[model samples]
Target: MSPTDTDALADDLLAYIDASPTPYHAVRETARRLEQAGYRALDERESWTLKPGERVYVTRGDTSIAAFHLGTAPVDRAGFRLVGSHTDSPNLRLKPNAQVAKNGYQQLGVEIYGGVLLHTWTDRDLSLAGRVVLLEGGKPRGHLVDFRKPLLRVPNLAIHLNRGVNTEGLKLNPQEQMVPVLGLESAGAVDLRAMLVKELSKGGVKAEAADILGYDLCLYDLQPSTRSGAHEEFLHAPRLDNLASCHSSLTALLTGPASREATSGVILFDHEEVGSRSAQGAASPFLRTLLERLTLVLSDGKPDAFHRAMAQSFLVSADMAHAVHPNYASLHEPKHQPQMGAGPVIKSNVNQSYATDGESWAYFAALCREAGVTPQHFVTRTDLGCGSTIGPITAGQLGIRTVDVGNPMLSMHSIREMACASDVAAMVAVLRRLFA
Candidate 1:
């Protein structure tokens, strides 16, 4: 794969990721593509069935999923190749009993989830997306609800009123400033459950407050992702941090062969932005269980072979890398300013924030050569603390030689993020070659 090809696919994948506002939506999009490519879905209650030349998938608690293909020959678990990534990012999550009416205004009460740039969320055109629970004929039902259009806005206080805004740098009070405007008072008292009931009613379901199972809802910018700048060389979008990785792995699976002599897989996890400790997160049994089940099924009940394959597996933890900001260039290390379109990054930190080491880096560099990608290096400033990911956690849990990699991104965790347009397609092409 050439750099040009990777850049093109990156843009395509970024659009897909930007469209998925929640983990459920992310998994749904992935399932759609897999089904299109002739991959069969599995029921959790079904018995194990092993067959050669069949594409397989496993789901855990709705949000996390692992997909792989069986090769013509028996796969060596000891030499398996895996791409690991997460589905979650930093944002605001809706709280239960979320409706709050104040001074004739209707607002949705929300809690900050993960490490988010709170100030970036204010004054943006926002829309809600997540799963909704309902009662259909007295039974619980799940529905994917996406208010695609801009339905709310958290307006910032005027500069004239906030005399300290410029000097103090706009300190945001999450409770007061983050309230999203729903409708006018004449629109009547805004009951959140009632609004949900009304929306679910259209889907043939009767919903009540009690019928509301917890949701993973988020507010996102309503703007569509697109190429920008005079040369049309930059990509502007939201949630590019880890979504870029999710899209790349999914695209690689679809475009690459069904199976190879070695085991190849893609795992997308949830709650990575919040320390990855949930039931479906990197810290749980999700990945381990999926691999064990796959090995058991692929080995035709041969425990010895399955164990061998498990011992030989390798994983690539794909997350977004930080690019050197032109305005804040002083914050980055001089020698390690990872440039956009320079190629994919192998992120490293001595404190284990990233899991890449000498051995893992070398192996990935070899794979990049085979895939025709020029692998780049990323390191943070000496005086600052670095952000962590599922990379080190998964490495500690699975004992796999894991390499941390991603596309360089600017304005990370902002309501609207930016990256080079060419890098998107470049990543896809490289992933295709690696998966092959």
Candidate 2:
């Protein structure tokens, strides 16, 4: 691809992330694109009987989904070419009994659910979104709720009141500072479910509490991702840490009408922001169940064939890589600071935080080279603690050879994140080759 094409692709992907304000929207967009490409939907409750050349998709919850295509040729047990990414991002969340009033101010109590930069949430406009369950007549009605506009905010306390805020640094009390102002009035009794029901009803959806089986909901900034810098070198947005990977994986999945030479699969999961233990998370049965079921479908229930396919399978855990911050260059190891647009990164950790080992990294290095994308290496400072990811967990669970990789970015968990514009296209190119 030429530089112009790369810029076009980055612009396209940034638009997708900007449009996907919530996990539900992300999954919905993904499913819509896959279906447009002729992928059939499957019911999770029923057993799967897949035929060669058939393409299918499935979702565990609104937050996670997987799509794969069966090769027209015999299914290779050596395992499928699996690419994985997370759909969730760090943000404030509403509590079950969320409504509360203080000093005539109507606020919705929120719980800090994951590792987040709390200071970033202050004074920024926020919107409500997520899945809501309600009753339509007698049965449960599952619906998605998105305000898509500014609905609430966590106003910052006046700096004059805390003279030492900058000097001593700021500390936020999640229970206090994180509460989003809902309205001026109390809105009568706190019926959080009812309020949500009414919101969905506006979308032509009517339902009750029992009508709601359950929902995975979250609030997001309605801010759009923008191109910045004099040379248009920087891309700024929310959830870029993994969303970049998510968009790249989705694009790669579509670039193919892939062949039976290998089964290419993509897993966009939720709850990674909170350690991935949920049903739709990496640590759960979603990936394992789907892989096992796929193997059986390919082998026609032959255990030996499934085992062989497993041996041939490979997985790429696509998450965001940290680029060295120019302002904080001292924090990164001199030789290991991966630069923005330097290329795709192959992340490694001896502590097992990332799943990549000698063989897996080598395999990925070959793929990167074939795609003409430079591959870099990442390892945390030994003294500093390392963060964990699904790469390690999924590798252990499936015993599939795996390499962890990502696009290098900065201010990873910040409310608004930044990455190089060219890096997005670079990673997309590498993924296209991997899926190819």
Candidate 3:
């Protein structure tokens, strides 16, 4: 890809990361894009009558989404070409009893959601965004909220108070040190539920404190994603670990040519950062249920057609890969060090952390070669522990041939992460070829 194409794609990726503060928001943004591209939404509770060349999508719990375009050939003859990615990232989530006041200061109690770099969260401007459930006519309803302003902050203790912070490293307790200061209590007690009701009213959603049945809110940095570096080759953003892959895969699905030989699709699952056990996660039956329904509809209830389609299907599990850190070069495998600005990476693990095998690896590498791009390889060092993706779990569930691949990045679980701008375009190009 040329510099102009790379810069354009990087700009789009940054916008996506900035817009998506939570998994619910990510799915909503993706659904917006898919709908703009003429894909219609299908309700799972209702009957679906699908036809060839039809573009359709289905959502589960408003967090996970699967979109597909039927091909000209029968599904049993031409199986699915699928790209998978996750929507969740490591962050702080608000607890049920979140309101707490100490020494005339009000704070929100939070629970760490996943493996987070706790220190990075200190001394940052934070805001709240997620879904809140409200009661309406004796039923619970959900509404998306985005407090776009800096409503809270987690300040770091001064250096003078902790003199050995630099050399000895700073340690924080999630229960005590991680609570964010919302404001000061002036008069009497501050009712947190009433405060939420006021905020919702400002956003044009009328509700009372009694109407709030539940919520799933999280705190996020207020900083906007941007392109940095001398040549603008570096991109810095939040939630890039999996959202970058999600954006690339969605773009590829929308831009790729409608194939006559395969049914092309993309799935963005939720809850991967926290072990993917939810109804919308990869460990659940969401993907398999959709695939079976599609097969049954396409084959007119033919016997064994779903299994036949699975036999010929292929899945490319896309997640962010660890790039060789400049400050810690010795941490990576010597020969298989993936570099920023390099092309996509093909990841493998012998212990089944990733699903890449010889056959699938060769298949993906050939796709990259056909796209005129060089593919990199990644394997964790023998002495170190390896992080996992949804690749292996999804493959085991469906018995489909799967390959793990992604763009190289740094700061895997930090609040703000970095990546090469050029790699975004490269991965999108390879995925476009795969979908075509």
Cα-lDDT of candidate 3? 0.91
Error in Å for residue 264 of model 1? 1.4
> How displaced is residue 190 in candidate 2, in Å?
8.1
Please, what are the lDDT tens digits per residue for candidate 2 over residues 50-93? 78778899987777889987766455543588899998888887
Ranking by TM-score: 3, 2, 1
Candidate 3 residue runs with Cα over 4 Å from true position: 1-4, 187-189
Deviating ranges (above 4 Å) for candidate 2: 1-4, 186-195, 207-216
Relative to the true structure, candidate 1 reaches a TM of 0.93
1-436 in candidate 1: lDDT tens per residue? Answer: 3334645575677668766888888888888878887888876678868677778777776678888876565554335678889887778778776777787777888888777888888888898888886665677667877777787888888989999888889888887777788777768877766666676677676667677765657787888887888888788888887788898887777778655766678899999988889899999988877777777766655657655765677788989999889899999988888899787888999999999999989988888887667888889888999888888998898777888989898988887788887777666666767677
- The model with the greatest lDDT is 3
Give candidate 2's whole-model lDDT. 0.82
**In order, what lDDT does every prediction score?**
0.79, 0.82, 0.91
C-alpha RMSD between model 2 and the true structure:
2.3
The stretch of ten residues in a row with the least summed lDDT in candidate 2 is 70-79
User: Candidate 1: global Cα-lDDT?
Assistant: 0.79
What value does the lDDT take at residue 200 in candidate 2? 84
The number of the candidate with the highest TM-score is 3
TM-score of each: 0.93, 0.94, 0.97
